[model samples]
Target: MKTVAVIDYGMGNLHSASKALEHVADRNTRVVVTCDPETILQADRVVLPGVGAIRDCMAEIRRRGVDDVVRQVVASERPLLGICVGMQVMLNHSEENGGVECLGLMSGNVKFFGRNLKDAAGNKLKVPHMGWSMVDQHQPHALWQGIEKNARFYFVHSYHAHAVDDEVAVGRCDYGVNFDVALAKGTVFAVQFHPEKSAANGLRLLENFLQWSP
Candidate 1:
């Protein structure tokens, strides 16, 4: 049976993410939410989901020793999905918490959407960039299999990822500015938006991930 491990480092809405994964997973697949490094490394796939601040998230990730597990999973070439702060932590550094160092798995930086932001209509844009936004698929990838083009995904983040190389970005979204909402390299796929909260499209993305080989 296929096993998918949802890394639990004391951050993320683990219940929601695990439930969503369970809901979409096949009868033979097992979805486990755990902090155990052995379980994570042995799983068929790994998911790192986070919801809170980068500093706290990174601290817990390191404290729980999940950071090494994540690196190992990435190195194993097994599919790894990172959500929200989980994705941000993969960058070189985050502008949040006065700039915190990250895993540096990807060559990029996390930047906060400045307060002086505005929409095309000149209306003040919110800091967190909450609510749903259309995701513009930049390039074709396995994760985008069943998801339609320009599908709206749920987002609730202030800081967004900026890839050093544009080729890493597989999806883009606009919130007063165009920023990368999804990144893909080899077997790693991460998104700033919350797929579990994104309704149909979000669930479809997760389902696709479950079946994605590379």
Candidate 2:
């Protein structure tokens, strides 16, 4: 059976991610949420799901040696998905926790939305940018199959992906500012929103991922 390993680095949402993946993944596919490097390395596909401070997330990821495993996964061209802080940690650096260095799997950095964030109309917006927001699929990708053009997804974070390789974003959303929500390079695809917390649209995205070849 094909295996999909969801890395459990303490800062991740293991239960929710595993359940979500299992819900979409076929019976022939095995989903293993583990902290073991070998388990992750052996998997046909991998997911990096996280929630928490970037500083602590990086600390625990390195402490558990999952960072190296992820690098190997990308190097080998296995399909890898990063959710929330998991997506943030794949960047070069993050301004969270005073400042934290990331895995640099992708070319970019995470940034804060600012203390006094306001929408286009200048309405005061919250720091975390919580709740459902529209995600515009500007650049088409396999993971977005069956999902609407500007579908709403659950978001709960103050930081967001700023720029990716200085090119157009695959998915862009406006909270108080325009930021990248979904990114794709090679076989790797990442989203800043929590698809598990999202509804049917979220499930569709996951299903697309399972069927996606690239």
Best by TM-score: 1
Best by lDDT: 1
Assess candidate 2 and give its lDDT.
0.88
* Candidate 2 off by > 4 Å: 166-168
User: What TM-score would you give candidate 2 relative to the actual structure?
Assistant: 0.97
Per-residue CA lDDT of model 1 for 106-187, tens digit only, reads: 9999998998999999999989899999999998998898888999999999888898988899999998888998998889
Query: What TM-scores do the predictions have?
Result: 0.98, 0.97
Candidate 1 residue 100 Cα shift, in angstroms, is: 0.4
10 residues in a row with least lDDT, candidate 2: 162-171
Q: Model 2 over residues 80-160: C-alpha lDDT tens digits?
A: 999999989888999989999999888898999999999889899998989999999979887888888899999999899
